[model samples]
Target: MNNNNFLKPLLFVGPHIILFIVFILIPSVYGIYASFTNWNLIGDPVWVGLDNYKTILTDTDSTFYSQFFNGLKNTLLFVVFSVPLLIIIPLLIAVALEHKDLKFTSLFQTLLYIPGLISISAAALVWSLIFNKQLGVANNLFGSEAVWQTTQPYAWIIILIITIWAGIGGNMIIYRAGINGVSKDLYESAEIDGAGPVRKFFSITLPSIRFPLIYTMVMTTAGAFNVFAQPLMMTDGGPRQSTTVLMMYIRDLAFSHGESIAGLASAMAVLLGLVILVISAFQYYVMNRNAA
Candidate 1:
């Protein structure tokens, strides 16, 4: 009986464990190894020790150096702009939908969540037309003559708009679930104590959903760092590559025309991963300490 109980649980989780090890763990280990070597994805990887990292980090006159810094700067800008909106808008929507007087909550949730299910490529195409300079609805409606794709801040604005639109649903669902799990008795007690909506939210709801807040914030920041599609399709990292993100640079280096700079790409990827790890760890520490 004891063996059967153990076997049954393993049966349920074993496949996932195998898949994670095979796909995620093995690839991650190999990628880290590859970052130390020169690889073109076809020939045998030539061990170059820290050459790739040194060039990317210290070779200020190199094109790789310029690309790395610019890409990282743009990526950080995206995270700064998008992460807060992604968290706050979803949380606000989730809170609004939690109102007792709200009708058709399920319908609203479905409508919001459906966008997230759509592919980023398709969403970008749709948004591109909406922001098209000659015949776009944006110009037609607003009576402005700005070319959204080629303009400075307008280029960034559309990327953020699409990102937030597709992203809002998933985090909102998480917040809604977190909000739903809070005990109703707590709200009633707050009401009895003459707590207003904002007060109750800060005191009761926020504290109750602390884990979800931490989760969404961390995940959203990580996702924002890896952003590639919106800028790729919407503006093609245009207006002098002002919107080019780190992932775009990484992809270009790894698989661009002619020789692939796999080693450099892997180094960039590893660096980006370290940045994410440090930030996520800091966020976890701060949020966990506050919760405690």
Candidate 2:
């Protein structure tokens, strides 16, 4: 190949490579290094080797140990509650919208997808008003006397509501695109075989969109594990820190009052990343194996 041929491809992808290195790669490398050190975000990171990891992983009597485990437990709870709904609900909506009888399909799709574009912080403000104890629509419409944010299951309920509302749109759009791309010939053949809607869905539609299904599953699960803003903005990790996810603890440690404990924070972040990586890998493997 001529030099021009080689350089042209580079020209197309050079900016993206540069951006990834500067924004993602370098920072990730530095963060991992920071996790092994004693740093307060200043005075240079002191090389503490595995001290941070040891404290976080085995020092049960340490406050960081309790915070890490508690935050992790709550984070896992949020993931368990949210990921499945994010996948299944969107898939169902996408499949439902594919019906020939459905009118104004684009309008409905746009309405659903729009919420995903709204920032979580802004969306939380609107939801907060709706779930407000006294003046909110939820209480007035139902005529019930219950505090939504300061209660046990209620606090988690509001968080999940906003999360599902804001999240459903993106995954729905992905599923719709995946469904649309599947060949109509397959569906027609399934119909000729006397397959009903439910049967066609399980036998043909799902199999055809397996790639998108797996892609969304892994991505959604990873995102759910990193969940921070929804619980933070919605419930402020309240009702006694029951809603506090790992990210909240990590953030507080990195930017705490008096002195920052960024080394420990970085260690926590690294652990969270490892959890996400391992789970995402497992999801991909299982889905791919089943698909095969």
What 10-residue stretch in candidate 2 is worst by lDDT? 255-264
TM-scores across all candidates? Answer: 0.94, 0.94
Residue lDDT tens for model 1, 47-92: 9999999999999999999999999999999999999999999999
Q: Model 2 TM-score?
A: 0.94
Candidate 1's C-alpha runs over 4 A off are 1-18
* Cα misplacement distance, residue 174 of candidate 2 (Å): 1.2
Backbone clash tally (model 2): 0
In model 2, where do residues sit more than 4 Å from their true spots?
1-15
lDDT scores for all predictions? 0.95, 0.93
Candidate 1's C-alpha lDDT?
0.95
